[model samples]
Target: MAGLVWKDIIYIKKMWKTMLFAVLFFILFSFSRNDAVSSMALIAIMVGSNFSMIPFNYDNYSKWNEYQYAFPISRKTAVCSRYLFGVIVFGCCALIYALIMMFQLFIINEIPEKEDLLLQIGVVCFVPVMQSILFPLIYHCGVEQARLYFVAIFALIAMLVIGCSSVIVNMFCEENTIMIIAAMIIIPILLYIFSLRLSINIEQKKMA
Candidate 1:
């Protein structure tokens, strides 16, 4: 499993420049001055999370999936590794966004309101939901096929988030921040568990 995760990391390293460019582009686009903080954060999280799929794309391009079966690893391990890889990538993106938010508040003298913070948290929590849908698609359909639908899926999610962020925050936020935070933690774990199971089954079928 560690080797599988490391393999994806190595692929990311090889394409570091492309990843950097994409990140920069997202950051710039998110900071386009017309968007709200929550919208910007959501876009950043989406873009960042999507980067994890690059490894799968590379795998397809190089026929690594076929080659992977030559090793001792099981399809379940391969699927779980991708999920873990996504979690790590998403975590890094979240951390970077947090740091940037802090820098904006402390250095730039721009403080975000409580509502803004809550909305950002809400947006971040939604990332795993997107991943839960996407990973199984990649596993079953192959990355190339999945990539086409990826655009549509992301656009739909972006529309929902951007269009209904206020309503979502209102429904989830209320007066207690703890409840929303708990949902953020719990919901993603549940979704990821389901996603892992689905991906494992799909990979097993592919292997068979």
Candidate 2:
């Protein structure tokens, strides 16, 4: 599993510079527009959630899926490694985004709004939640087919988050914000676990 995870890390190493450049460019753009928080949150979501998708394309192009069975690895290990890789990517993206946002806030000598903070917290978990739905589809179908579903679903989710973030935050009181954030984190984790199991099953059954 670690080897598989390391393989993905190595595969994506070249992407780090490009992703970082895109992130810094957007951060400056958002700050200039005076909509840094929301824009950064969206950027984090867009980048973090889709980090593994390109690697999937690479895998397909290299016929890694077909060649994987040539190794002695189990299907469960392979699926689990993908999920683990996703967690590492999402966690790092979220952390880096938060740190950069804090630095930006410090530069402006401004504090983040409570609603914005809560919304940002929710959005942080949103990547894994979406991935939980996406991974099983990729395992059952192929990455190409999964990408089609992912685009539609991702668009809908991004719209909903943007449209309703403020309203939902304002609708709830401070105390309820804790519960909301808790749900945001917990639900995704549960969904991720379930998705991991489902992907393992799909892989196990695929060439059995």
TM-score of each: 0.90, 0.90
Candidate 1 global lDDT: 0.77
The digit string of per-residue lDDT tens for model 1 on 1-208 reads 9998998889889988877887677666666666566557666666765677888888888888777778888888888888889887878677767876887788878887777777777666667777888888888787878878878878777777778867866775476788778888799889999989998887788655
Question: Candidate 2 on 27-124: residue-level lDDT in tens?
Answer: 67667766555676677766776786766777889999888978999888888889999999788878776876677588767777777677667667
lDDT of 2 at 187: 92
**TM-score for candidate 2:** 0.90
Quantify all predictions' global Cα lDDT against the true fold.
0.77, 0.79
Q: What are the RMSDs of all candidates, in order?
A: 1.9, 1.9
TM-score quality measure for candidate 1:
0.90
